[model samples]
Target: MKPHVVAAASLLLIALAATTAGAVTFNATDAASGTAGGQRFDQAVGLAYASQVLSNASTFIWSAFNQTSPADRKPVDAVTLVVADVGGAPAFASGDVITLSAPYVGNYSGDVKTEVTGVLYHEMAHVWQWDGQGQANGGLIEGIADFVRLKAGYAPGHWVKPGQGDRWDQGYDVTAWFLDYCDLLRPGFVAQLNAKMKDGYSDDFFAQILGKSVQQLWQDYKAKYE
Candidate 1:
C-alpha cells in the first residue's frame, strides 16, 4: 500500500472506535423553510441526505488528516447544518455548526447536489481540523478545507489549475492548488502537516516535511506546470 493508505488503514481501528459510541451525529435544519432554496433542498437534497453527506465528510477528513485516535482530533459529538436565508459568504463553519446560505443555494446554477456536497466537505474540515490553537494562518485554514474539497473531486470548473495561483498561501482554491502540489512531493504530506498543527503552525512546516521552504516549493510547482 502507499504510505498514506497504510497509515490510514492502521488508524482505521482507532477511528472506528472513536465513532462507534454515537459520538458523531449529524442534524440538518432548514431555517428558510418556505424559501425557494429550502424547497429545492427538500426536493433535491433532503435532511437525511445532508446528514449522510456530513457524516461521510467527517470520515473522509478524519482519514485525510490521519486522525486515528480521539487525541488526534476534536471531540465533536455532533455537527449541525443549517440552511438559512443569509448573504455574503456561501457557507461558513463555526465550531461544529455549518451554516449554509439559502440565497446562494437559490442562486447557484448547475449540479446543486454536487455543489452542496463540496461545500459540506469544505465546512466539515473545519469541524475536525486543528487550527494551531488559533496560531495558524487563516488563509492556510481555508485552503486546507478547500484541499479536502479538491480531493473529494468537487473542484469546480472555474478553479485555477495547478501552478496558476499567484502565491502559495493566497487562500481558497489558490492555496489548495499549492497544497496539492506539496502533497504530490510527499504522499500524506497534508495529513502529516495537519497533525503537526495540533499545537501551533509555522512556515517551517513546509521545510520540515518537504525539505524546502514553501516559497521555493511554490516556485518549483509553478515551474513544473509553466
Candidate 2:
C-alpha cells in the first residue's frame, strides 16, 4: 500500500514538471497582468511576424538598391513593434522599433488583421528603407513604404483615387495610392524608385523612369486621378 502511494506521487510530480516545461516563457520587464493598454499575442505568431518582416525587408533592400551581394546590404537588426496604450495616435516610425498604440487589438469588428498587418508592413519598410541622405521628401518616404504594402496585397479597402492631396508626397494612403498608379502607368516604376532611395534618394531618379521631374510626374498623376 505504501509503495502504491509513493508511485502515484511520483507520477504526479512528473506531470507537473512536464507542464511547467511546456509553458511559454517571456522576458517582459514591464508587462503587467491587467493594464489599460496591454495585451498578449500568440507567441509563435508574433515571432513569425517578426521573421517575415525581416525577410521581406531584406528583399526590398536588396532589390531596391544596386548592392552587388548580401555583403553590400545595409546593417539592419532587431526590428520590434509593440502594442501599447496611446490614445488617438496614428502610426509613427522610430529607430529599430515602432510601437502601435491600439484601442484594442480584437475589439474592432473591421478588418483588424489586414489593418494591423498592413500597418506593420508599412512601418517595417521604413525601418529598412533609406531616406535618401535625409534629403528625400517626407511624403515620398511614406509613399514608398505604402507602395511595398500595396504590392504585398495587404492594402486596406479604404484607399481611394491618388493625387488628391495638395502635394505629391502627402504620405500614407495618399502616397500609397499614387504609387499604385505609377506601377500601372510605368511598369517596375516603384521597384526602380525603391532602389534609388536605397542608395540616396534624389528627385532626378524619377526622370530616369518617367522622363520628367517628380513635380511634373505629380502633376500628371494629379491630372489623371483628379
Q: Identify the candidate with maximal lDDT.
A: 1
Pairs of colliding residues, candidate 2: 64-195, 132-201, 139-169
Residue pairs with colliding backbones in model 1 are none
Q: Give the Cα error of residue 23 in candidate 1, in Å.
A: 2.4
Per-residue lDDT tens digits for candidate 1, residues 1-226, read 9999998776552222112223687877777768988778777777777888898888888889988776677888888888888888989999888999888888889888889999999999988998888999888999999999999989988788877878888898999989988998898999998988998999999999999998999899989998
lDDT of 2 by residue, 1-226 (tens): 5999999876553222111111211111112213433333232124345345445544654464444464554464444455555555535668766666445443444755556667767776787677877878888888888887877777877775556777767887788777777778788787677667665877788888888887887788888865
Off by over 4 Å in 1: 1-22
Candidate 2 — what's its lDDT? 0.61
Q: Determine which window of 10 residues in candidate 2 has minimal summed lDDT.
A: 17-26
Clash counts for the predictions, in order: 0, 3
